[model samples]
Target chain A: MSDKKKTGADILLDTIYKNGVDKMFGLPGGAIIPIMDAVKDHPIDFILTRHEQGASHMADGYARATGKPGVILITSGPGATNTLTGIMTAQMDSVPMVIISGQQATSNLGLDTFQEADISGMSYPIVKHSYLITDPKEIPKAINEAFFIASTGRPGPVILDIPKDVANAVIDEDYDDTIDLPGYLAKPELDIDKIKDAAQMISQAQKPIFLVGHGAIISGADKILKTIVEDMNIPITNSLLGKGCFPEEHPLNLGMPGMHGTAYANMALCECDLVVSIGSRWDDRIAASPKEFCAQAKKIHIDIDLVEINKVVKVDIGLVGDAKDVLEKLHKYLEPNDTSKWIKTVNKFRKDYPLKYKKEGKLRAQHVIEEMYNLAGSDVIYTTDVGQHQMWAAQFIKINSPRNWISSGGAGTMGFGFPSAIGAQMACPDRKVVTIVGDGSFQMTLSELSTAVVNKLPIKILLLNNRYLGMVRQWQNLFYENRLTGVDLEGNPDFLKLASAYGAKGFRIRRSSDVRKVLKEALQYNAGPCLIDAVVEQHDNVFPMVPSGANLDKMILGFPQKRKELE
Target chain B: MNNNIEKHSISLYVNNKPGVLIRTSLVFARRGYNIDSLVVSNDSNNPKFSRMNIEATGDTDTLHLMLAQLNRLVDVIHARDLSGEDILQKELSLVKLECPIEKRTELLQIAEAFSAKTIDLTENTITFQIAGSSEKLNRAETLLHGYKIKEIVRTGKVLMTRGEEATA
Candidate 1:
């Protein structure tokens, strides 16, 4: 008879596979050597990330794209610390990710051993839940809980801190535990009372504004936001984080409001008498001043997260549920309320700002963003890394739906866009998913391209090669006497060469007008992952500046005289 | 503002989870009058639960809220509102002084009396970290007036409500 003895590692891998994990993004370590050894023989693919943050981002990307939990593994100490940013990002964005970190042996847990940091404790604020699995027998249950917590409503990162001995120790459990999530249960069921109240408010309003946020995207409520906007014939103004929630090019889209927002956008926000805020938390940035944010509006706030409902600004009518569901249900009550004058005013504002960029060459960031919106059409999802590129994408990309605009909003992690796009592409492979990243942010987790290539997931990447930390430089211009300190990149990698190095198709655009051709070629080169090194202006910064801690209404409006000259 | 009024601040360490703050808040709600400035944060190196600072205004009503809210939040394993009847309390404050070089010696002498630790010393400024009751920290601040006082960050008040039977 064939011997059926299996090591603890085998059982662990089996459990992970049983949970439907096809891949893991991580770096192997001494503590997890046995698990790594077992996985080497298993069918599961272990992606080797350049950094632990990259692994977390890959997992986050995978999760965001797939609507499933992304999995990651890292060693102890610095490895665990590196993932803090990604974890906080996931927490803020509510992305479902399961991170497995190695810990010192059970005996050394409290003894302050080498390569030991209280990882579980450090990640407290950022994770849904975490565990230190000291016993082999508890591994299956802990993992089951981790996956459950990470995937449930209010989705966020969860950590499993497994001690070395526990990972190696043998246990004879069936390992067939199903997820038990009794604490969390969230669905998009419209609250009837609030909906009726909101509908009543919407009916009475003359000039209404539709303010959409990240919550709308997560709830897949773009169609709902669109339906309401179309039905009401109301203009839509987005927060900085809500930039891509609505299609920027849409006739009714008024663009981003608050600090760093266009003057017209903020004016539209202030002018609207009735505000229909969907899936958005009226954060300080968007609100400007709490008292002045929507001083004239009869606010109707709809969001799934209840804590965000009245946290910042009070609303006339607050509805808690998934944005899509609430909007869908509210559709019946809405009766095509016309606000022609309101739409006209918003159109005027949009015309005034026009999401403008100087006519730099064809390879400028503006062309890249415009082309991305054109090539991808209204169906593809677009994500972006933090920096000038993120703001540029936010300023330009015309998203037709909610979830189509995935981004690292609150935490603003650099390497989130690419990996998230990979996840988005993986989940909806038939639909195009593109990522816009700056050279600075791209280097943070560019290795994720390997995961996409290996998985045969074709994701288009627009590397806006601005060889400086654009956002920080913008800050220096306003705050720090323009010293420009530590913002410039002296030696940047050749992205086209780098993309080619990773077995992916690469393109380079240097002229102002060649953007369309390069982008068209990239979208067509769909055999595998592709990267376009769109050489953009190095000094270009996201304008309509609202200096830090400054009120939103006080935005500089992008070199006022220059703006008038453009007009 | 009411000097004669008796005040209590309770600090607790509990598992941090969704609905924890709600449960703690519900406790106060059920008892009437809510917490004044209830700050929920994690204890250093303890990931499972957080150290919650519950500052309640009313006397009898405060106790009820603390008891009720603690019971409500599933993740909140413990809850307490400190009272003078039980437990030791500590408040930490870091004050940045705009002291000229000449007044630096006087400020240092005052800081020593309060057991304050000097955190920063510049040509025109001196910063000190003082740990004690809110009143004591305030007194130390008053003594450093000759120098320019730039900013003050008070850690608020954290209390262990008497006769400790391990709340968590």
Candidate 2:
């Protein structure tokens, strides 16, 4: 430390390395050449992505899969602006990510020099925090603080806008590893009285339901949550981001609740006497009409972020602290309860409202997902893009492990699937990672296929080749009186040839019966990436949908499974 | 707007750095709270921090959440809404109004009742200095509304914890 002089770029890499980051995703540009040149000396693998947006999404995917902060490096102006969608996706879902965008030299700032942009200003609303390191000496502290802020509390994206001059400047001072954030409270002390209050409410309620969210996985409360649910005999539901927190195969789990959520889950939420939301802020999707989301239930919210409490809907008890800490405390006070009647009622609702499709008709996205699950099993990680395919994957695929289901829940970014799967595969090389995407969404960032091929990432792609933007078309079909506008994808290129162009294997299936055989072959191709273009029914719409401004009880259950034709 | 939708006096103690003030105000702007007035000064006991006072109007429904968001900023050390508390809040306003020879007597009488001091006197304009709560200042301005008001500069509220609890 005493013998060598270190430049700001070196210090940035050094500090991030000390914080346990080994890989980053980004593209090179003029303003970032100084840092790009310094990367050769560092141990971090710079996974150069095809587009800056892809880099950001890949990093987000990596972070979500591993529960660690993903790092990104790119240039200023267009480079920084391109990552906005990815950053907002991470921000909405609370994934941990750090981004470094190079700026013009300090002398050229505000003068609109080449590649100059106000990144910090542009990203203020989305980023958890940001640092403008015009001074070289601030590199270490800013890097360390960015990592700390992005990985703690309600994790999100943070950015560092470093000018080229600062990145080139050298310093000889030593950097110590002490974080001094006076106001950012990462771990709030447990409020025992509130936990006891929630526990007492749980004990007295005959009909109780749990709605766990992404925070449950973030806090590693899966095992404790499972134990609590089993002992209390409570039915449970999850948010889209909370898909893997509770095993979907468990009998007590009632699946997701919201606009396209399972009918039984929404009905249980409507009928429950007590609803405990563990580490979840009831977003608009979960409580679209907040006033009537659970008008009949006593709501208790347990979350680490104090701001999220009472933000969307008022709760009877708001416990502010880490989910794991509060759950452990509440577990001790919980007593066994007899909820046989309540359980039986919810089970009946589940049976009567089972999710279905025209089983004997054309191939559907849900069938492809189920066949993929049958072939890949619960061990493989599945990522999905936005729109119909995403909801279909969520409704059909049942992942048994936490951190195995990743998607853009809040932001609904369409091009998030392929790049994120590449990231997940890179992060977990031994495990299988597959992307269930639609034709419209897949073409949004098909350029990333080269990224996977160049990196030799063995990720699989299950393209639901439905020739239209199915979700929007469905809305037009139902609400807009069939006047579909700009929803067609007739110009999409041949996906199998597209995969072959990128040096990967591709397969196609036209019949529902071929789904299993094709998926088995695609899942077994371990040498490189595989793409399965499953031609699904074009007009199928997700059911049990609570339309905007409608309550959970107003679900439009699909064409009431035509009372079976008499023999 | 609801019954609680009224003006709120918020005080923030933050690092006296280049970008802290913008970050502080961004929170209000993003939350859709209208800022009526804002004042920033670097007279805090701690040199590393600056004091900011903002008079904004919004319902109390998400006010606490707004404060939490402000406190989450990197440069903000602490933030509080001192409204509805027995706190000593003061602001200074210099109001320059038309003062013709015929209106001088009436202006003097009105200034005396409001306890406003004459800060400047020109041939055509008289400027009065008023210091007190925002409500008092508003009332004083209403009395001089008949006169042609030329210009006014106000230092938004400065809050001090009334008894012994430290403001910071």
Candidate 3:
């Protein structure tokens, strides 16, 4: 509203502020100095992370925890390149984010000048959209469009690379709010005929199962999903990313179904006559092998992105639209049906073959996770790094609401938990945020502990230190005849001292009996940030696991039995 | 899985922006499809938009998915598989052949048979330009194979519907 001319950076920040982005996560450098200077006058909070990768993941975590597009700003070249993994993680998981990278001056582009990079070109394949702004007049328009495109229609990350000179250049104060993207379509109209057909299919099926994915949570379709499940009396299973979409304690919930899925969930998937998938891609982990997944069942897939419809497993009815809208329309035509017999059969399987481990033994990672769940209750936001600990957390953590369970599911990126927990805590200051990370995965981005301390984020880190890359070691023990090479963590640092150096609280529990007491203290600690290093049994393996390339029903429950016995 | 790779003609209507072409082409590259020919220009009716015609070879299922992926790009308004439609396709090519005095008469006869025009002639080389279906250009190039060919430049295929129905 000011009549004075503004720099392109100010205009860009103003546009972002207008779009409801109040927080940004990133580091500053030379090329981005102008924008950093302009931030002094803005009301937005800029969280400075130790590394650009951490910043990007924080943004992704913030977006996943809250249903808002997280923002990231960093320098060009190495700083921009460092965010590729985080950006790809968001892209794979469909987390909404806007990455603003500072590039060299426009005149020096393609000349390989200092800190110059073709960031827009390099990120084109991974990003939903990318822009390289040369003219200062287009700053406001580009920022607005980037935010719009990032947060709509199967949301993903978008990149905007601004040259130094462009950020420093002056522009008129008048900002146009009109978005003129002729090709960008945010929502698609649902086909009512398709919905009616899907409803008919559901009504006729003797045995039906609902396979929920992260899209259900992303579209805020929790109530719709719960209503459909209750009205239809169907058992629901979740993908790894879809863990918290349906309440875990619900009687119809069959837990997560995949490679590391529960025995009952996998059994229910194999026995179902119809699989109604909502907002979930049939990735390799979920499907095992596309040819063998749900071989006896017809599938009804509903998703926002059309590309995910027949990309993996062909469905009998593929409805491409927003899940909430499609489900609302489908609910009208669906009659209240009952599958009590089918539910009885699924419940029998769930009761007979539950997720169990030996109670009397050295500390197990699963026990620690279950203890944390009991101590923290079901209201906290939980995250995990990629490893056996992640699978344990997914299986044990009981989440009752959407956006409460945040992890890098699609990308399965290591070191995502700690920083993501920080973002989640920042988004919801009143809610408790906990990150369960493995020993190997924790070291990858542990530098973000400093960020948590600096920002006074109350994030509890449950470090399951098994003295090895537990997942790979388990694989080696099972398949490679226990030939453990390069999987051992012998030279690991004393985590307590490291936490102290970062000005954070740290605790350790070496005995199995101390898990409940120590976890209670860690969760209750009102301090800024805390790390609990629990030394678990090194050889503990996640049970009810479907080995790679195996069928969904071929699970290795407990210790490895003979192949014939498993069959 | 079906392993048969067939040629597909895909037409795309996109915003006339700087990185739109690269964004569209990256989809093909990422999917491991080789673009045999590509033609891009501003739309005649709408100056704000452009038309891109891409000729690529891939399995039918993969190409079908690629069409969906291409349509997902922010700049692309619409994308369709034009191969199965009743469409007219054309490509222009200029071939420079080393024409010695002894082979001038024979080359001229071959060019005349293909209805190619002689764009430039030099002491030892002659350039022939031809515009038509890709099949016609291929045939013309094959007929001139006996002569010493110096260079060949081709503008990939551009397509339009046969009837009054517009693709957009």
Candidate 4:
């Protein structure tokens, strides 16, 4: 509040602190030494990650878990580039993050100096916004604006690049708390007419389904969404990122739809007369082939971003506003209807072809996930890496609340689970955080085990040791005449021994009987992080998959077809 | 899988920053679309903003996706397809052709027919400057292509709407 001479680094830290950021994840480097030194004087808790990519994913996981903006700090050059994958992951999933990267001195820039790169230019496409601060006086305003842009509307990551000299320079100026961004528009008001039209369409349709997405969680519209589903007696399904928005145990809730989704959910989408999508972009995974995704349905799309309305599939009615606002308004104009016949049909479909797997010999990944769901109940936060393990977790794990299921849905990044679990654990110190990763995905960013050990984060790691890239192997088996290449991991390291090297607890289970016992032991081991490696079946493929370029009705259930052509 | 490629002219109004130009153009280059001509200049009324006109060749679906991506850029305030709008487009080009003593009179007559001005004249070369629509400039260049052309410099197209409805 006082106009005293302060260093730019101090102003930047003060601004972040004032914006309600208590923890930061990153590493220290040469150009960012001043900022690291200033961190000692501040009250923020800095978690030093082993790699910059790990730091970015940790921030993303923290944001998804707590509904707050995650902050990250890194040095110049390679440090900045290493965070690209993580930044793109956050941008794809709409997570809010503030990334501060240090740069070389202003005089040393453009001279091919040591560890100098155009961080702002490189990150422009991936970030929501970026700022390069050259003046000491502009430090506070830049930090404030970066946080505002990151956490508002369709939230995403933002970057602030500061030169070494700018951080060291002293300026006599007061911190400006007011944000003056003429170009940035966060939330748009709801159009009542569009909501009314959507309500009318839903009432007139014979069978209507509510397609919810991550936007519901972002807008905190779980209550309104539940009300709409219950009042109208409509069946509801969620996207991969929207797993926990609605309770999976509810009778009115169908599972996810599209590739790797349940047969009942995809059938319901194909048969419904109206598909009311809220806060979910019609991604390729969700819509498969957009032209024929729901040919029989009259679609209504609601989202906060105006550009995503008709980008994929054209909708009959498009409402550009917050999910909560639009749902609340639509509820006012809707009336209770009897959808008993439609619900009965959907129930029959669900009962006829339920999600099942063979349970005879070796341990299956689905069985382990089901056991974890039963033991952990509804109070745990779960994260998963890409590939077969992620799909298994999504299909079997039961999430009872919003913000409890976190994954890299859109980008499908492999090394996202472990560091993200650490972040989620940090955000909710009392809740149990479990990360399920496959053998191939776990090795990508295994160095983050040190971060958990150093911070004493009690995150449980579930490694599905299948010894192969399970998803790609399945694709090769089905589409490429079973000629697998480079999918085997024959000489993989022992995960239990790896955990021991990081000074943590490790366990292994090779039989179905030992699954529950080992999982219980890992969850109860509260001293530090625990790694439970479960050796599961190798050639098992996810069921009820709609092949590429196929419609929802053309699903391969249980196993591959007997003939070479379609039936 | 639409293979019919056609030229597209897109205009954007963006914040005038040091790296905004590269950021704006990268969107096109990443999509594998070749930008034939790109013109950028600061807005006279508002010095803080700049207007950019880019001409690229792409298919219909890819161009639509590119426009959506361009509008999502942080520095861009507004983007529009000026090719379909009622607008005026012009390009300026300076062409240097090899001219011998016997062919100097013939080259001057050709330049006079196309309303080109002789900007630079040497003993064996003449640089004629022409300003007109893109089609007109292409026609003039085609007429001078038979002669041995030494060099050519072109200022890309700039466009403005006909009525008072501002592009931004």
Candidate 5:
């Protein structure tokens, strides 16, 4: 074998290549001049986004679209801070991304230097891990480790702050140093005793229900979740965050049990004797009143994040490990059984209050969602930007697999879907990644299309053009006497034209009949990112919305027949 | 070899901060359980929330704890147990050893066989890196004693784990 000597930047770019990262989303800077110069001659394409935030969002979208960690590069201070929202969005949703920021020279680090901010400190809470490379020798290790940490279990972002001096410094040390990080070992094995105990409770319970969450997708445990649910014949209800964990059409699947969830789904949860929560933090929106959320049920909470165990509602059995792993183990302990009564009751409620949309309109948001869901199929990885579109996707999209739906669950960041889909696409290149963004949220990271074009990632973007911030407008309609505040954007770009300018395929779906045709064409392209501007009705809203502080039992049904009057 | 396990206690002085304890516990948690009575506190002498005293069982745990503790920011100031009469226990080590390609497969087999993970390897050259208590390093050195040793660097032990009622 021939020996070849390479510079730090060369090694770094080679490392990215080895990791199968074909593109990078970032803006050039002074500190990262060496890397910029190196990248010019490298195999990886550098996407120059309009802003650092846009670049980060594109990286985020790529990561969401694929399972690979999205890579974003930026300069110090303002450039670094600009990616904060995108970083926070990925962090909240647990999307894998690597944010590489150029830092001031090591010699000027603590001297209150120019273009320097405590970046590692600033991103500490939000990132999976962080590194400030002051030595050129550490660059290879840092980059390798950042990728490892970001793409691994319970995926999230990792930021590497590369100082100017370090980037320019020449290190004589060999490039193949295998980094040993003894301090950060998070391989949690399945605790057998806890599993046995949980199995016993689940086996004996009359009304056992699986409350699936984002952890199910993160842990890659959808198969295990489905097997257990099917074997035990237990009804499964997902949190809004857990929408795609199970196929919505599954016999026992109760779609999205939360604030705006079906009345029967909420009732089933309320009445169930056993609630096995997998990979889900008991967020208030899902469990409106934790004390009363599932007072009738004994919970078996399994999650990878230890901090989330017994956080709000205390669980009878708290097995802390990756949900996917734990579920794989738990499947063995369960005996084939039946829960027909529970299934019948849930089905009855499901039939009575089935998800409905008012027809006889010019265009309905639900129609777009159904068409999109059908066009992409269950195998597609879907991401949604916050607003009415997100809720509509939750209701309409029948996600049959894990890691299928990436959204801003906790923070509800609007501009999140577009960028996170970019991140997802980069991570899982084999599957089609489609991001559903509203007219308002799409504008937030709309500049990221340039990155998509540069990288040549085929991420289908479905912009649900409502021409208004639907969620805020809904809130205003319900509470503020329909007083629309700054919820309206007067002049929005023609999305088709915008996509074309970025060198992408674009389509505009105005009539209801055109939805499926346009969506099918978008998904089938398989060449590069495609944008479908879905001109949905402006006044459409996400119904079954339980007003904040209102009881989950009480929700605003879209139609009179859809509302359940519980005695 | 298991007879060498004479429940040793080595307190590691470290920085008290969020995720610090987890960081310290992770090293031992990776290999197997190492720590016995791990205690942490703000040093009275340095009231800026500085020290941590980690006591571990088994010589391997003590050595591994010592090396792992040194990497932490708070532990940067000083880390050691207070043993009487200056036994001169310096806890710094860097080894750049070579195992012949002919014997390389066997030597590396011995290295990895003995938990000596490789750091870097070239066609004719290979680097083995390990950080732990001096005794563990000495044992590691003995295990690879037959290999051609190229270079060895050591950082002196600052102090030893304190005894009953000792401050971190």
Candidate 6:
């Protein structure tokens, strides 16, 4: 770097390479020509994506799978604007990511020049931080700060807008070790007194439940969280993204809770006298209403973000710090509790209203998930799109390790599964990566299959082609008096042919009996990407459904023909 | 509850960099806080930092949350709410009135009562400059309400604690 005159582009790419990033995802355009030109000089390999949105989502999937900030590069204007959804999705889920977009030259910034945009301005609300570099010398520090800011605290996306002129400007800049960010609070100190108070409360409580979420995984507190739960003899329930924090197969696990949650977990959360939420925010989908969510529990909210403390629901003790840090101190003052009676009640709920579906009637999504889960290896990483299939996957698939379950939980974004699966597959090339996608959700970013085929990523896609936007259809069927409009996908493309056209393997699960066979073929096909289109029942809704704004106990366990009235 | 409606003063010490003002305003706007008045200028002590004095009305809980978010901004050095502390506050207001021949003397008397100075005078109009709290400016404007007040502008409130302690 000293011998060669490095331009701003070289410095930017060098800084990224110095940060330990070997590969990045993006598409090249006019605004980013300088950066693209410098790419040949650097050792970094760039994955050419069909669209910038795919680049962002792929980066997101990579970030979630590996606990590092996923890096993305793109041009300005439409290219930068296209990454907003991915940025918002990652931000909502607290995934760490960095997006570098090329801006118009500094001289032609406000004249509405070609590919000119105020990207950092547009991304202000979605990103953790943003920088619009006017000087080439600022590139090194801006990049370093971006990576640091994106990966620290409650990890989120950050944007670095480098003008084309800045990228082409020759500068004698080098990556610096010092980070000049005084305002950012990356790590908050653990309050020992608050931990003690929370432990004391847990000890005195007769009925307690451990509600864990994505934060536990982010903080790497799974082992300690399990230790705390077992020591306190509490039943544990996870949120949608909370899977893999506590093993779903564990005897004390109550599975996921909320709108499409398991009956027992929701009941346990609703009836418990004490609720210990570690890392999980009080997301709206958790229950019928925030007012009634864990209304009886003397709640203890432990998280890394301070704003999430009294954000939605109030808590008695709010410990604003990392989950692992608080749990480490909390481990010092723990003893077993006599949970004979509460366990009996939790077991009764689990036994009486277990998650059920019509196994013998038709090829339901539940059956497909069941067969796929049974067939696929237990160590597979599952990323899902937003819809009924995502919910069914959450209910059926049981993850036992952290970072194995990736989904668009908060944003509920469709078209996330395929590209994200590509990212996850690239991140963990050794592990099996599968995306449970719906027909509606899969088509949104299905163009990325070309990226997968070209890159030769061995990603398996489980496409549940139900011919409808099933989640919205269910809402319309239940809430809007069956006046379904805009939920039907009548003229959907043949996914099998589409897969073949992209030079990827394709299979179809014709019925419940064929699920295991087709999934086994897809899962075992390791040459490149494979798509398994399981055309499930058209009107089959995911059960254990808590109607929006309804209390947890008031669940519709089955369809109307087999419905059981709640007491 | 009574204190919730009253305008809360937030003082921020931020890097004198571009987009700092927009970033600070974005935090307040997201928390649904309306900025009644704001004054931002270069910090006298250090040219590298800027001082922003903002007064707004909103719920106390959201205000605290917004402050935390604002303080976390990369350019914001420090942000603090000084509404509960004992402080000296002031504002300057300029009022131009369409004065009749006889009303000029009467308007001067009203201005004198409020310790106002006649900064401008013409055959048909007079303009008064007054300095005090927002309430005093409001009273001065009300005293000349019946007359045709041509223009009125007030520098939103600014404050500093009485003790030798930093506001931000």
State fnat for each of the candidate structures: 0.00, 0.63, 0.77, 0.30, 0.00, 0.60
Top-TM-score structure, candidate number: 3
Q: Backbone clashes per model, in order? A: 19, 0, 0, 0, 45, 0
lDDT of each: 0.74, 0.88, 0.90, 0.89, 0.74, 0.88
DockQ per model, Cα = 0.05, 0.68, 0.82, 0.42, 0.02, 0.67
Residues A1-567, model 4: lDDT tens digits: 345467888888989999999999999899999899889978999999999999999999999999999999999999999999999999999999999999999999888899999988778778888899888888888888889889988999999999999999886666565776765678888888888998999988889998889998998989998888888999999999988898988998887888998899999999999998989998888797888989899999999887788878889999988899889999999987779999999999999989999776889999998898889887899999999999989889877799999999999999999989989999999998999999999898889999999889899899999999999998888888889999999999988999999998999989999988998888899899999999999999998888887888888887744746534
User: Interface RMSD values for the candidates, listed in order?
Assistant: 7.7, 1.5, 0.8, 2.1, 9.9, 1.5
lDDT of 4 at A195: 88
| Alpha carbon lDDT at B94, candidate 5 | 56
Residue-wise C-alpha lDDT for candidate 5, range B1-168, written one tens digit per residue: 123554444445554444455655665565576665454556677564455545455654345344533443222344444433333233445566665568777767766754666777766666776555567778877876667778875543333333554433
Docking quality class, candidate 5: incorrect
In order, what are the TM-scores of chain A for the candidates?
0.87, 0.97, 0.98, 0.98, 0.90, 0.97
For model 5, residues A1-567, the per-residue Cα lDDT tens digits are: 015345667767777788789989889877778789878878898878778887777787676555677898889988899999888877887778898898888888877777788787777556776777766887787788778778765678888888877776656656654755543445567789989999889988888888888778766677777777877899988887787678777978888877767677777887789999888888888876666768777999988765566656778999988887788888888775567887888788888978888655677888988877776688888888888888888888887766677778877887777777776776666777888889899888787787677768898888888888888998887666678999887899888888999899998889987877887888788778999888888987687777675556666675334223311
Minimal lDDT window, size 10, model 5 chain A: A558-567
DockQ of 5: 0.02
lDDT order of candidates, top first: 3, 4, 6, 2, 1, 5
Worst 10 residues of 3 chain A by lDDT: A558-567
Which candidate, 1 or 5, would have the higher DockQ against the true structure? 1
CAPRI-style docking class of model 6 based on DockQ: medium
lDDT of 4 by residue, B21-131 (tens): 877788888877788999999999999999999999888767777787777776888788876767888899999999988999999998998899999999999999999
lDDT of 2 at A273: 95
Residue A311 displacement in candidate 1 (angstroms): 2.4
- Higher-ranked by TM-score: 2 or 3: 3
Model 1's i-RMS, to one decimal, reads: 7.7
- Stretches of model 3 off by over 4 angstroms after superposition: A1-4, A562-567
Each prediction's TM-score versus the true structure: 0.75, 0.97, 0.98, 0.95, 0.75, 0.97
- Model 6: per-residue lDDT, tens digit, A33-90? 9999999867988989998999999999999999988999999999999999999999
